[model samples]
Target: MTDRSAFPRRREALAMLAAAALPSAAHAAERRVATVDWSVLETLLALGAAPVAAPELLQFREVAVEPAVPNTITDLGLRGTVNFELLLLSRPELIYSSSFYVSSEPRLARIAPVERFSIYAPGRPPYEPAAAMMRSIGARLGRSEEAERYIADTEAEFAGLRERLKPHAVRPVIPINLGDTRHFRVFGADSMFGEVLKRLGLANAWTEATSYSAMAPVGIEALARMPDAWIALIPPVPPGALDVLAGSTFWNALPSVRAERVLQLASINPFGGLPAARRFARLLGEALPAERGHG
Candidate 1:
């Protein structure tokens, strides 16, 4: 018992001094990540882990993110052409990417522990898949709270939107990715868009099949069945393609077209990721009318 009380106070002071001298606990545990999509990068940032470099999709470079810690977000270029050397030089601890690209590229594993999740499946809806990706990413980052919060927020937003647009919820919606090839794509039961629409209490017009697939090219004749349904356009198409389609006889005859129900959306990134989920919800809200009117 020789000066034990003094020893306790001294130990506490030493601990405080050590903590003060050392970097913060948050900084000590921080991780470096490299990702393909800004959406995924944003999710990690949202979860408090920002990537040192990420692909700046030409269209999405305008996004505003502030307090911009780790400001150097390198643009590694686009799909199928990642700058491996650039990414490797950064020495990221983890690289998050879409499964499609990872499945094709073998060198990703060599750089670091690569985590693959799809955020841009061509014909796939991205909500549940994105939600699942968020969970996986959160687990990897040891941010379980973030994952739960994302899911809860998404569910809450969807529920509120559904309730607000209940009258128009029953209206059938179609997802089409118009392009030079004239790809006719629609979200299936398992797609992210499907999950959002399902959550919003809306119905998918296409019942050809459930799995994501390239729909058989439909001409004006096919529009007879559900002409009154709304058409939701996805992206990657030239800006004027919709105008071209609109002028075409095949597109002009559809009841939905005639009724002006076709809604152009900037959020058809697909691939089932968190960004897709959030964007889908916002797009759905925007696409649906605030108040249903006689059509």
Candidate 2:
């Protein structure tokens, strides 16, 4: 039992099937694809392809926010928990995924061919892989031209951002996403944020190796050690973490905070590809200059 009674109603949804990823050279129509990975989904959007279906779209909206997910693409559910029965009914021709969900690939492949990509590798920077994925996916989608254009445009944007930041690249940048006031996730050299910061001609404050490019659930005391750094706080701020930080003497007394060197960056897909790199570079471009003398 998978409750076959619901199959007939969902059959109509099959026609609106999402596009596949890294498809074969045949043609776009031959492979009906969907994706459970946000990075893949966003890459599809950036390449101007109609994604078959995307997982955790609502959350993606809050975090990744660029090239924009359309209202037309269906939300399959969270990345870890997808609607397998719905996928089965739709008869997906393929499924685009990433290393983040490798354990789920077998299950996903049961419904359709599963093509997986990885940007985050142990001790390796994700930027290059992300660019390669864009081109590869674009070629598979028969949109290689568009992929090159996007890559060029993203690189040009990064170049412009680097030039814009040159004068004030004064301090090393510490990028973080708050898990709560007491603990947070810091992006290291292998992270998209850290690597992009390097691309933007800025130094990353967290020099140590990280477990898969980030170190999480770490105490605030760690951040206090980077006295001359600019704290780049990535959001969706943990509810009232800011309020909690506002009153605590320990928070206010931190050298970076006391010097007003914190840069509040909008949320980004920390392990993402080109679109995320572009979004992050843009966020830094806007935030850093605005905080110049004020810091």
Model 1 Cα lDDT, one tens digit per residue, 10-84: 999999999899865444344577886555765776667677777644434333222133556666776567788
Superposed model 1: Cα runs more than 4 Å off: 1-7, 10-30, 37-39, 59-71, 118-126, 180-183, 210-221
Looking at candidate 2, what is the lDDT of residue 139? 78
lDDT of every model, 2 decimals: 0.67, 0.83
TM-score of each: 0.79, 0.87
Against the hidden true structure, what lDDT does model 1 obtain?
A: 0.67
Worst 10 residues of 2 by lDDT: 15-24
Candidate 2 per-residue lDDT, tens place, 1-295, comes to: 6989788768756634533344535345424668888778878888777676778888898888876888877778878998887767656677899998998888988888888899898889999999899888887878888889999998899998888788767788899988998998989998899899999888999998898889988899998789988889998688888989999899999999998888898788887788888888898889886547334
